[model samples]
Structure formats: structure tokens, C-alpha cells
Target: MPNHIDFVATLAPGIFSYELATGGQVILAMDVGTLVKKGSDVLVSTRNAVKAPDLGKLKQVVVQQYDVLDEREKMVRSASAKLEASLIRRFVELK
Candidate 1:
């Protein structure tokens, strides 16, 4: 399957948010089979996709991606404790 970034890029511009709502609806409706099918579709579609770079290369890419932000912008975008906590929890669960 494609790496997460590529998969998301290919699917939709806001699939992460969309998926949360869609998946929640599916769960609430008790449609486990549909949810499984959706997951299977993602895996099948991305089975032959290119893999992402290793950690070091990805770090460089992240730096480059954020390089356009000036000091003020960086400050404005500075991490928040609440956001960090949520991200950390997701990261830990995913790992």
C-alpha cells in the first residue's frame, strides 16, 4: 500500500475529516461490513503505490515543507498543549 501521506493525497483533499464522520456514521448504523469494505478498498487501491521515504528523508521533506513559514508564522503556528496531547495519543495508539 502507499505510504499514509500518499494515500491521503490520492484519495481526497480532506479525507481524514471526511473519514471520521463517515466511519462514525457507519459504526453508529452498525454497518461493520461496509467499514471493512472501505478499508479493503484502500488497501487494494494502494497495493502497488510507491512507498514513502525513510524517517531521515521524511524529516527533510517536513523541514522543506515548512521552510516557507517565516518566524511570525511559525510563532503563530506554534504547538499547543492540547493539540500536542491529542497528536501524541494518536501517535502512540497508531504505533
Candidate 2:
């Protein structure tokens, strides 16, 4: 699939998040909960469709188009930088 190409894998103990783009046009966020690789059986929590939200699981699933997520990340990073700067200023002012 197209997503496989731009997919970035992140593995955190007890949680895993994978980012991919569908047909190189849409971004997909796949979160696998409680993954276990047995001798022969592999378990995964996945949505049924790609384009829409799948309420098949209890945990919240988010899938944003590639461009949307890029924008969000930029905004988040920008806000974070501003917050950090403010925090530092506060600390300096206290002294």
C-alpha cells in the first residue's frame, strides 16, 4: 500500500504507534493496543476502514490526513516553544 512507504514505526513498551499515508495522499495513525506475538498467533487492534473513523474499539482512534497532522504538529511545536520560554522567564523573574 502507499502508506507503507512513508510509514514511520514507533515502539513503546505496552504501546505502539505507527504513522503512514494512504496512497501517499492521506495520513493514517494506527495504534495497536496490547500487542502480543505468540508462537504463531499475532494480535492487533485495527480499524475496519481507512477513510473514516472506526468505533470498533474502546480506546480512542485518531486518523488524520497527512497535511492535517503536519499542520497540527507545527502548531503544537510552536506553542510548546512559547510555553517553555514563558516558563523560563518566570523562573528568572522569581530570582
Candidate 3:
């Protein structure tokens, strides 16, 4: 049985569009420059080797983790990190 992939929850789902693949999808996790130029896919992930099943069920658990971490990390007074996060969010929104 393939592991279900809850990309939204684990990565902190935003108001963006997504394309699911039956019960089998893969979300590649990586770090890359955000909004490098313009109109870029920042968090681009290729289908993983593992096929996801029951994305809905997995989302509940993964989203919980995302929410907890995101909430606490939201408070950052760092000028540089703040700026970077801003750009990254924008990129994610567009992508």
C-alpha cells in the first residue's frame, strides 16, 4: 500500500491551486530562492516514488503539524528573515 500524501497540511496550505493524482501523488520538499525573477514555480515538486493514498485523511494529521509550527514561527522580528518570508509567500501565492 502506498502512503498517502497530505502536501497541503504538512507544508502549510495557502490560498493556492493544486492538482491531485487519484490516491497517489508525490510532493517534493526542497529549498530554493523565492521569486528569483518573476512568474516562477518556487515550491515545485515532482511526483514522488511513493504513491499517496487517501490524501484527505493524511491532510488532517499533516495539517496539524503545519499549523502548530507555522503559528509559532510567524512571530519573527528579524528584518532580513521577514523580508525573505514575504517574498517567499508571494511566490507561493503565485505558484
* TM-score of every candidate relative to the true structure: 0.25, 0.40, 0.24
Q: Candidate 3, 63: how far from true, in Å?
A: 1.8
Candidate 3 deviant stretches above 4 angstroms: 1-52, 77-95
Q: Give candidate 2's TM-score.
A: 0.40
TM-score of candidate 1 relative to the true fold: 0.25
lDDT tens digits by residue: candidate 3, 1-95: 13433232233222223355565344422222122122232343322221224556455645665676676666654666989999999999998
Q: Which candidate wins on TM-score?
A: 2
lDDT ranking from best candidate downward:
2, 3, 1
lDDT of 1: 0.37
> Taking the candidates one at a time, how many backbone clashes does each contain?
0, 1, 2
Query: How well is each residue in 1-95 modelled by candidate 2, as lDDT tens digits?
Result: 32233333333323233344353333334433344454444445453223333333313343244456689899999999999999999999999
lDDT of each: 0.37, 0.48, 0.44
* Winning model by lDDT: 2
Error of 2 at 71 (Å): 0.5
